[model samples]
Target: MTISVNGEKKVFEKAQMSVRELLDALEYKVGFAVALNTTFVLNTTYETTMIKDGDALDILAPVQGG
Candidate 1:
Protein backbone atom coordinates (compact mmCIF):
# COMPACT_ATOMS: atom_id res chain seq x y z
CA MET A 1 0.00 0.00 0.00
CA THR A 2 1.02 3.56 -0.67
CA ILE A 3 0.50 6.28 1.90
CA SER A 4 1.70 9.78 2.54
CA VAL A 5 3.51 10.19 5.84
CA ASN A 6 4.43 13.62 7.04
CA GLY A 7 4.23 14.93 3.46
CA GLU A 8 6.30 12.12 2.00
CA LYS A 9 5.04 9.13 0.09
CA LYS A 10 5.81 5.70 1.49
CA VAL A 11 5.06 2.33 0.03
CA PHE A 12 4.51 -0.80 2.07
CA GLU A 13 4.32 -4.43 1.10
CA LYS A 14 1.23 -5.10 3.16
CA ALA A 15 -2.29 -4.42 1.97
CA GLN A 16 -3.37 -2.95 5.29
CA MET A 17 -1.72 -1.87 8.51
CA SER A 18 -2.73 -0.45 11.83
CA VAL A 19 -1.39 2.88 13.02
CA ARG A 20 0.62 1.14 15.71
CA GLU A 21 2.19 -1.19 13.18
CA LEU A 22 3.12 1.66 10.90
CA LEU A 23 4.73 3.55 13.73
CA ASP A 24 6.74 0.52 14.77
CA ALA A 25 7.85 -0.13 11.21
CA LEU A 26 9.01 3.46 10.93
CA GLU A 27 10.68 3.31 14.37
CA TYR A 28 8.76 6.21 15.84
CA LYS A 29 9.20 7.10 19.44
CA VAL A 30 6.44 7.71 21.95
CA GLY A 31 4.77 11.03 22.84
CA PHE A 32 3.58 11.85 19.36
CA ALA A 33 0.17 12.73 17.99
CA VAL A 34 -1.28 11.09 14.93
CA ALA A 35 -3.68 12.27 12.24
CA LEU A 36 -5.21 9.96 9.72
CA ASN A 37 -6.50 11.52 6.54
CA THR A 38 -6.81 14.88 8.22
CA THR A 39 -8.57 13.56 11.30
CA PHE A 40 -7.02 13.19 14.69
CA VAL A 41 -6.51 9.68 15.99
CA LEU A 42 -6.51 9.11 19.70
CA ASN A 43 -3.45 7.47 21.20
CA THR A 44 -5.53 4.74 22.77
CA THR A 45 -6.95 3.82 19.37
CA TYR A 46 -3.70 3.54 17.49
CA GLU A 47 -3.70 -0.22 17.77
CA THR A 48 -7.12 -0.40 16.21
CA THR A 49 -6.91 2.40 13.70
CA MET A 50 -6.35 0.73 10.40
CA ILE A 51 -4.54 2.57 7.61
CA LYS A 52 -5.14 1.91 3.93
CA ASP A 53 -3.77 2.84 0.55
CA GLY A 54 -3.77 6.52 -0.45
CA ASP A 55 -4.25 7.51 3.16
CA ALA A 56 -2.44 10.46 4.67
CA LEU A 57 -0.74 9.99 8.03
CA ASP A 58 0.74 12.80 10.02
CA ILE A 59 2.96 12.37 13.04
CA LEU A 60 3.19 15.44 15.22
CA ALA A 61 5.44 15.92 18.17
CA PRO A 62 5.37 18.57 20.82
CA VAL A 63 7.95 21.32 20.81
CA GLN A 64 9.27 23.38 23.67
CA GLY A 65 9.37 27.08 22.87
CA GLY A 66 9.65 30.18 24.88
Candidate 2:
Protein backbone atom coordinates (compact mmCIF):
# COMPACT_ATOMS: atom_id res chain seq x y z
CA MET A 1 0.00 0.00 0.00
CA THR A 2 1.09 3.57 -0.70
CA ILE A 3 0.44 6.35 1.77
CA SER A 4 1.53 9.94 2.07
CA VAL A 5 3.32 10.70 5.30
CA ASN A 6 3.98 14.33 6.03
CA GLY A 7 3.58 15.07 2.31
CA GLU A 8 6.03 12.37 1.31
CA LYS A 9 4.93 9.17 -0.37
CA LYS A 10 5.71 5.95 1.39
CA VAL A 11 5.11 2.41 0.21
CA PHE A 12 4.40 -0.39 2.61
CA GLU A 13 4.32 -4.11 2.03
CA LYS A 14 1.02 -4.62 3.78
CA ALA A 15 -2.47 -3.94 2.47
CA GLN A 16 -3.47 -2.13 5.66
CA MET A 17 -2.01 -1.12 8.97
CA SER A 18 -3.01 0.52 12.22
CA VAL A 19 -1.76 3.96 13.13
CA ARG A 20 0.26 2.49 15.96
CA GLU A 21 1.79 -0.13 13.69
CA LEU A 22 2.74 2.47 11.14
CA LEU A 23 4.42 4.58 13.80
CA ASP A 24 6.40 1.59 14.96
CA ALA A 25 7.38 0.66 11.44
CA LEU A 26 8.70 4.14 10.96
CA GLU A 27 10.50 4.04 14.33
CA TYR A 28 8.47 6.88 15.77
CA LYS A 29 8.35 7.24 19.51
CA VAL A 30 6.12 9.28 21.77
CA GLY A 31 5.69 13.07 21.71
CA PHE A 32 3.93 13.52 18.40
CA ALA A 33 0.47 14.16 17.05
CA VAL A 34 -1.11 12.60 13.97
CA ALA A 35 -3.73 13.66 11.50
CA LEU A 36 -5.12 11.14 9.05
CA ASN A 37 -6.78 12.21 5.84
CA THR A 38 -7.08 15.74 7.22
CA THR A 39 -8.78 14.52 10.38
CA PHE A 40 -7.20 14.51 13.75
CA VAL A 41 -6.61 11.10 15.27
CA LEU A 42 -6.89 10.53 18.98
CA ASN A 43 -3.90 9.10 20.69
CA THR A 44 -6.03 6.54 22.50
CA THR A 45 -7.30 5.17 19.19
CA TYR A 46 -3.99 4.82 17.42
CA GLU A 47 -3.98 1.07 17.93
CA THR A 48 -7.47 0.74 16.49
CA THR A 49 -7.29 3.31 13.72
CA MET A 50 -6.74 1.49 10.45
CA ILE A 51 -4.83 3.14 7.61
CA LYS A 52 -5.33 2.04 3.99
CA ASP A 53 -3.93 2.77 0.56
CA GLY A 54 -3.74 6.35 -0.65
CA ASP A 55 -4.29 7.60 2.87
CA ALA A 56 -2.53 10.72 4.00
CA LEU A 57 -0.90 10.96 7.41
CA ASP A 58 0.53 14.05 8.96
CA ILE A 59 2.75 13.55 11.95
CA LEU A 60 3.61 16.65 13.86
CA ALA A 61 6.00 17.14 16.72
CA PRO A 62 5.80 19.89 19.26
CA VAL A 63 8.33 22.65 18.95
CA GLN A 64 9.57 24.86 21.76
CA GLY A 65 11.03 28.26 21.12
CA GLY A 66 12.49 31.00 23.24
lDDT of 2 at 22: 100
Kindly list the per-residue Cα lDDT of model 1 for residues 1-66, writing each as its tens digit.
999999999999999999999999999979889999999999899999999999999999999999
What is the Cα-based lDDT of residue 45 in candidate 2?
A: 99
Query: For model 1, what is the C-alpha lDDT against the true structure?
Result: 0.97
Give per-residue lDDT, candidate 2, residue 25. Answer: 99
lDDT of 1 at 12: 100
Question: TM-score of every model?
Answer: 0.95, 0.95
Give the Cα error of residue 32 in candidate 1, in Å: 0.8
**In candidate 2, how many Å is residue 26 off?**
0.3
- Index of the highest-lDDT prediction: 2
Give the residue spans of candidate 2 off by over 4 A.
Answer: none
lDDT (CA) per prediction: 0.97, 0.99
